[model samples]
Target: MIKAQGLRKTFTTRSRKGTQTVEAVRGVDLQVGKGEIFGVLGPNGAGKTTTIRMLATLIAPDAGQAVIADHDLLKEPAAVRRKLGYVSQAGGVEDIMSARAQIMMAARIHGVADPKRAADDVLKRFDLTEMADRPGRTLSGGQKRRVSIALGLVHDPPLLFLDEPTTGLDPQNRANLWDRIKQLRESGTSVLLSTHYLDEADVLCDRLVIVDHGQIVAEGTPAELKRGVSGDVITLRVDGLETAAETLKPFAREIRVDEDVLRVYVDDGEHTLPALLRTLEERGIRLSSIALDRCTLDDVFLAHTGRSLRDTGADA
Candidate 1:
């Protein structure tokens, strides 16, 4: 439902250091299939939002071409807008307006045949009926978020752009939103979600692209991406990190030492741990702790970017 090629955007900002031009997006390309939940995964400032804005026609790309629901982004922005729904991080709902009022207003603006019915349907679909009469300011963060999503669906668009849709919600609400998003896909709405949360992408996306420094470093299904980094991860807190790393080097496929922790990637963590412990003991190496875990999306991110997602500052 969406295709983008060579998308790029740059922003100029002034700081005490002086004016600097930041390349928010650089030649990013995307292809989202119909009825698929595609994710653009990245840290803040990694160009995920900029790429979404360009594809959604909310902002023009500096250099790129895109088509959403068969409408050219640059040549037919209005038509693109008609086929797509956008729920930004900071929802645009008015604080004073009740959930029902806001949804109704959106339906009316979208020229829905029956604004009230459409609004009510979406409110029910998003499970916001109980809070429909509550003012946006009076609702909880999760409630307001649901209302925002309802507003986006009021027009019955075929595609949706959700930029960090669950950034601030608690775990319960995040999971709830995930279910709603899954329903959208089942109902044949193509969703392009941009989020920094690894677990979100793993659980919610059919396919995803990892962006860093304004470029895509990797792209695939959650399982496919996790497979890119082989083996279970073994973390050992030892007294002599360097010696421990050398001792395990022969058995490990990959090794990373951070502070006092020696992390090794091995084909079989459970099988190797016992032998590794015996070897360490024979070498008189004292281990404070040891852990074995399956490779996760976070591990994939670290392999691609050399940093954890949480370490990437919220602003970036």
Candidate 2:
């Protein structure tokens, strides 16, 4: 149970001997229902982390009203901290300490009555029992990430904040972490996760808010966001894309030509692809590749932001 209204945070920095203020998070309104996994999706420098820091009570917001599990964040920060757990991008682990020892120290700091028992339990749950005695620095990247998660959950807080939980992990490790996050939600832990991984949000989030330039641009379930596009997407890569594009103009609801790839938006991709292929063949265009699929969150983003997620540019 977390809620925020008109949440904003700003910071001042010196650049080239000149001072400038950056509005990291501006008027962010977020609500996380009990036991729900709410996701914050944004690219780098999009204020997702800034909003999370404010919600965790680690940083004060410039203007906002926030409540965490019945405690006002601005008025009762200590009470809010007792009810929430935070796992940062840096993985929050001491390199020299063993997993069990590290978690035990965290439990003790949180004033858990049975710190030893709690540490043992979390180590086992996160599959770190075998390496519980090993120093954190000796653990593999995946292992260290899991240990960080275990530390965050050691206190058994009802609400959890995970900022880029699987940032640099391999695919296998990423999936493993996703499973653990899902299990937490199933066990009634309200999770607020910020991730740039589109597929991760598509698979794990129940509801998501897309943030850009320190503001929420869109909010919906994955299906709702995809459906916002209102059609199938047919992608064709052919030599002489400009000529093929001119020929396919009559059939296209919306056409975008990027390099040699021609992206056509239509009501039915199955029907559109055949006609598109026929037109290309008639025009003697050399087809390189063709891919047809339903719309995705990336498409939704491209539609709203006028740029692909993977576009290479200084702004992206």
Candidate 3:
């Protein structure tokens, strides 16, 4: 339902020194299949939101081209907007408006055939029926978020752009939203989601691209991406982490040290553990604890970016 090629955007900011150019997005290419939930997975400042903005027609790209629902993104932006719904990072709802009022207003703006009926249906779909009369300011963060998404669905667009949809929701609310997103896909609504949460991408996305520093480093299903990292992860708690890192470097496909712990990624953790232990004993290093687990999306991020996803900054 969406295709983008070499989409690029740059922003110039004024500072005390002078104006500085920031490449918020660089040659970002994406494709979201009809009825698929595609994800743009990245840490903050990785251009996920910027890419979404360009696709949603909220911002124009400095270069490249895109098509949304068969409409030209540059030449037919209004048509593209008519075919898609956008729920931004903040969920942008009026705090003083009641949930019913907010959704009905959006319905009217979208020219829904029956604005009141559309608003009522959306409220019930999002399980906000009981809170329909409550003002946005009176709702909890999760309830307000639901209302925001309800507003987006008032138009019944074929595609939805959800940028950090679960950013500030509690675990329960996040999970609930996941269910709602899944239902959307089942009902044939193409969803393009941008999120930094590894678990969210793992569980929610049918396919995803891992973006970093304004570029795509990897793209695939969560399992396919994790498989790129090679084998199990063995975390060892030991003294002299630096020395242990170097000592086990040859046996490990990859090694990272955090304080007194060493995380070793290798092809065969069970076979390598005995050899590692023997080597440590020979070097007179004390081992405190050791554990093995399957590779995770974070490991995939580390392998591709050379840094943990959680370490990225908040701005792109």
Candidate 4:
């Protein structure tokens, strides 16, 4: 439903030093298929929002070509807007307006044939019928979020843009929202999502692109990206970390040292553990803790960007 190439955006900020250009998004390319949830995963400052804004017609890219929902993004923005729904990062609903009223107004603005009925159906779909009459300010964060999504979906546009959909919700609410997003895909609404959460990208996205420093570093399905990082992850909490990592390099496919632990990637953790421990013992390394698990998105991010998403994103 969306295809973009060579998308770039820059901002000029005035400071004491003088005007400086900040390349917020540089050369981002994207392809989102119909009836699928495609994710743009990255850290806070990795241009995820900037890229989404460019595609949503809220901001024009400095240099790029994009077509969304079969309409040229730059040339046919109004037609593109008519076919898509955008829920910004800070989802908005008037504090004094009830959820039902807000959604109905949105539907009317979008020129839905039956605004009231459309709003009601969307409220029911998002399980917000019970509190539909409550003011936005009175609702919980999760409830407000649901209401915002319902408002965006009331017109039933073919495509949806969600920026950081579940950033602050609790686990239960997050899962609830996940089900709703899945239902949208099942019912054939193409979705474009942006998130920094590793697990969200892994569980929700059919395919994703990992962005860093204003550029896409890797792109693939979650499993494909994880599989690209060879071997299992063996994390060790040990003293004398630097020496131990260097000594175990021969047995490890890759090694990354965090603040309090060393994450070692090895072909076979079961067989490698004994030999690794012996080497540490012989080298007088003091072991505090150890864990072995399959490689995850963090490992993938590390492989591609030389940094862990766990350190940068708001992890669960």
Candidate 1 vs candidate 3: which has greater TM-score?
1
Task: State the lDDT at 127 in candidate 3.
Answer: 92
TM-score of 2: 0.92
Task: Give per-residue CA lDDT, model 4, range 102-218, as digits (tens).
Answer: 999999999999999999899989889999998889998888888888878888889999999898899998988898889999999999999988889889999999999899999
Residue lDDT tens for model 2, 1-316: 9889999999999989899999999899999999999999888888989999999999999998998999999999999999988999999888898989999999999999999999999998888899999988899888988999898999999999999999888999899999999999999999999988889889999999988889998899988988777578888888887888888888877788765588888888887778778888888989888898888777777777776655622122
Candidate 2 Cα misplacement greater than 4 A, ranges: 238-253, 283-286, 312-316
Candidate 1 lDDT over 1-316, as tens digits, reads 9888999999999999999999999899899999999999988889988888888788899998988899999999999999999999997878998999999999988889999999889988988888899878998888888888888999999999999999888899888889999999999999999998888998999999999999999999999987778678898899889988998898788888754577788878899889998999999999899999987777788788777676786422
Q: How high is each candidate's TM-score?
A: 0.95, 0.92, 0.93, 0.95
Clashes of each: 1, 0, 1, 0
Model 1 TM: 0.95
For candidate 3, the TM-score is 0.93
lDDT of each: 0.88, 0.88, 0.90, 0.90
User: Cα lDDT for residue 216, model 3?
Assistant: 95
